[model samples]
Target: MTESLRWIKSSYSDNGGQCIEWAPEHANTHGAVPVRDSKNPQGPALLFPAPQWSHFVEYARKQSV
Candidate 1:
């Protein structure tokens, strides 16, 4: 975790507040995506394998639509 992460908020997030953020640049180079709640920037982030995280996100997108 020595790398500087540029966390991007989820596109689906709105002002309603509950949201998540992910480090895409880290995922692209490291094959693991770090995700955290936007409300707690200092809290621990969960790491998910890039492929698995992609699949989960795709599934979630489909389910919501």
Candidate 2:
């Protein structure tokens, strides 16, 4: 795991500390979205393929931020 990956926040994350983080750069290179908790950098991460990640983002964007 490297900080070189640019982690982006979920749109659903607004004022609260609760958030989901993903590495867009990693996706560009690996074709997989590496997701983790913003509050816990060293925590476990979940990896989703591009299509699945797109669907997840679509669903997240539809929710209230």
Name the candidate that leads on lDDT: 1
Q: Between which residue pairs do clashes occur in model 1?
A: none
> Candidate 1, TM-score vs. the true structure?
0.90
The candidate 1 region of ten consecutive residues with least summed lDDT is 1-10
Per-candidate TM-score against the hidden true structure: 0.90, 0.77
Write one digit per residue (lDDT tens) for candidate 2, span 1-65: 74667788866468487888999888888999899988898788888998899997689678946
Cα lDDT over the full model 1: 0.87
* Tens digits of lDDT, candidate 1, 4-64: 7998887777847788889998999999999988888888899999999999999999999
**Per-model C-alpha lDDT, please?**
0.87, 0.83
**Model 2 stretches astray by more than 4 angstroms:** 63-65
Show model 1 residue runs off by greater than 4 Å.
none
Instruction: State each candidate's clash count.
Output: 0, 0
